[model samples]
Target: MKLTRIAQLGAVAAVAALTLTACAANEGGSTAPTSSESQAAALSGNLVGQGASSQQVAIQAWTAAFNQTNPDAVVEYDPAGSGTGRESFLAGAVNFAGSDRAFKVDEIAKGGFGACAADSGIVEIPAYVSPIAIIFNVPGVKSLNLDAATVSGIFAGTITKWNDPAIAADNKDATLPDLAINPVHRSDKSGTTANFTDYLSANAKDVWTWGSVEEWPAGVVGEAAEKTSGVVEAVKAGEGSIGYADSSQAAGIASVKVKVGSEFVEHSPEGAAIALDASKIEDGRTDGDLAFAIDRTTTASGAYPVFLVSYLIGCEQYKDENVAALTKAFFQTAVSEEGQSSAAKNAGSAPISDDLRTQSLAAIDLIK
Candidate 1:
């Protein structure tokens, strides 16, 4: 799928207006009571964030929406990969970070101001939800069904042809081509890579051989691109090319449906929501650290098990009160019903369930 190029001028202007309005709202206070008051109270300054190219669509929506209401604040997010985002956040180069995966236990152990809070630890809330679409660009085939093994085999360079029996068996009705299958992968250490590898490891462990890792595993390899955009572009330019990316980013590409169990399911916001709803929160974390143990192998009828839950990581407290306020406001808006819905529309991502939304708001409260 190709990434849409919307003009940034209008988006930037809209965001600027939002920043001003948010600052005024924070200063003047509102007589009207609303469910998002806490979020409003935390609005006031500029914020810098970086991470997750997979969440680019959702993040752009979020920034644009937040700017509409908080016109006085500025929030800039760089769509770097997950690894770079984590590194920047840990180094305190950014006020917050967007990541597709949660921080490792070792990262938590490293004491840092942003990593640690006054009373609680840092907050990692799953805010954006979208399926990792298995996108393809093949001339003759418009649709295909790929099981976990076939997917792993293709990316691992084991299955090299478009007419492999395994692939043909899944798409018997369609005309199969004998073209060489060129699989694309992420060159950087990315959470998207982690999610994809995790699915392979969990479902096709025996054949895959490699376990999930942040950096791509050594044995299984393919042509690698730097970011989600790079992978999308590569797939678009090459015939018989296949790659996995966030569903929203696959705008003009043909995505393959995967057989989750007995059903062949296409990636969708509703389907991603089903998988997220089936997940449970991770245990043994502090109050401020809101991590989840996502069950990616869920076989629920409508759920796409390969969905990605992009997290918003923030410090519990900021040295600058204005920065704290801005962070809180941004987070509150992100977890709000309106905000989540906006994201759904602009990014093709699912909003968090009410149960998770309630918990997420409570976690944002700790950001002060």
Candidate 2:
């Protein structure tokens, strides 16, 4: 799969940065070794990773933390969309990828991932979990709870005004405007779209006919932005606009509280953790391939239904021993409690549960 020009530039810059850092380290005569160089030495080479713009904030934090501990190791991840990340991983353009979705059954059957041992299967571990916030820019509406149908109607274009009865029912006390509603969506092929669509499909199947897919379905219409930041910006700029984005990216915007079972639940780190706890790994797959089958339709109280678990997709074995070691080391840190804590500080994402952590660590040990 071909990468967007922006992603290609990012990959080039990452490699160049590593090259310059190595040259500087050699000139300094400091055998103590810088973190980037040490990682490079450990991985025996430079590492390139790309995919999942939804995890951009968390990835940046993880990269910074990993660099501090392994100075010589140079690792770069570009926040391309999940479709691009998966394509890059399958094409052998990256050492690993960060994605919101696992590889499809067909892709696995075709032997798309070269990183796994023959029949060893691929690893798709959910390292980051967060709520998909329904952010809006209505001037006075700060808090709102939307049931499944109302949300489906707004995005489906059937409900065009903020003062529509469906919305008014959810916020009976608030003064909603009669202005036209603008619904913003991601223009790119995104895992955010998949998660959002999955929620809609599961909860309001009659209103939303689209099945869960990375690319938005045809005939389903809305204003489209290229990334989570773009969608957030669009909503912020347009009055009466609503958009779906990773909760961490919904800065300065009003987010909607979704109705869960019997309560109107606001999205929080705790709520997301509850959702993860309610999920289980898919039954099939080898021990090394840590793919999970989350129950998105779960009605577990206190759990936000819009929760998304982002995965760090990587090969079980790498041709370069150093890359393999670096991948394993960085991932080990990521799955650890310390790494999860660091991510929460930097990105406001939900940490993996202790149970999931144990499973992930055991799976990472099989990476060799």
Candidate 3:
């Protein structure tokens, strides 16, 4: 469950500069440490997490806020790909892991999360939810609207030219030059790729032949890059290039407004949040675990289907007591209203709903 609410900046690209709330002292002048101080005092030593480069901006905000309250708590999170993060967590290299996709049933059954106690159930909590913008660098095309079928064709390598009628039909007013279209993709194992492909497969199954996968499939033609940043950079360097990335990183590029049913919708924090609200948890995932099954066939007029629901995964019971305690505290601050606000300010992400907050807090309580 995610309690965090992601909000607006500009075109969902200008992350509104976050203003810090002043911490006023208590009126009683009690020497007793206030709640914030006590939380800080309660936490000491380092906590580490690794995964999902898309969550880097949010992690920075969450960690900074955590450190202010608990100066002694040194939390370090490495923005490695989701595959690396999951590998590290299962190998006991990190106390917690952040991933765009939740653990599969087979993975949960394997029982190799080295940090967990012998019989501890995995706690998969949905923390960050945001839109993955379809960013492009096409000359004279400030805004191009493409429907799912056309998008699938371009990414699938069937639509090679920018001025192709299939694309031109979508953006009739935009002067799409007769240039070769280069589709940049993530070469590395990435959750972003998984979600992006999932959207394609769901909305345009006939055109997007390659099904949803973390790694790009065989015979799929595209300029492959290492990670989210690499994909963006690759697209930026090439003329008439297009790539998909988290909306936060798409500041300089022209993001496409995707056609969802009758209307083309721009990516916004509220737009993304509405999609999540309409989604449901996956089947067989009960108790404290949360793995969202986003319906990519969403007809929610303004909601964006290319959204990522990032998860912060940990063990219900840890082998090291301190790891469990520290992990719990870090996440507690992560989903709090202040923590959610920090994410919005830094990443332009939508905040999680209130019911999700309650379920997430309940899940956190299980981290014994």
Highest-lDDT candidate: 3
Error of 1 at 283 (Å): 1.7
* lDDT tens readout by residue for model 1, 1-368: 12222224235643554456556767998644224453434354668888898877666666677665665667777787888888888877888888989886677766574533443368888898888989998887777898989988998888999999999998989787899998898989899888888888888887777788768766565678889989999999999899989887888788888887799898899988888888887887777677778786889898888878889998887766777677877787787776677677767889998888888888888876
Give candidate 1's error at residue 89 in angstroms.
0.7
Residue pairs of candidate 3 with colliding backbone atoms:
4-351, 4-352, 5-350, 5-351, 5-352, 6-349, 6-350, 6-351
lDDT of each: 0.78, 0.76, 0.81
Higher lDDT: candidate 1 or 2?
1
lDDT at residue 153 of model 2 (Cα atoms): 89
Question: Which candidate order results from sorting by TM-score in descending order?
Answer: 3, 1, 2
Query: Which candidate order results from sorting by lDDT in descending order?
Result: 3, 1, 2
The TM-scores, one per candidate, come to 0.89, 0.87, 0.91
Report model 3's TM-score to 2 decimal places: 0.91
Worst 10 residues of 3 by lDDT: 2-11
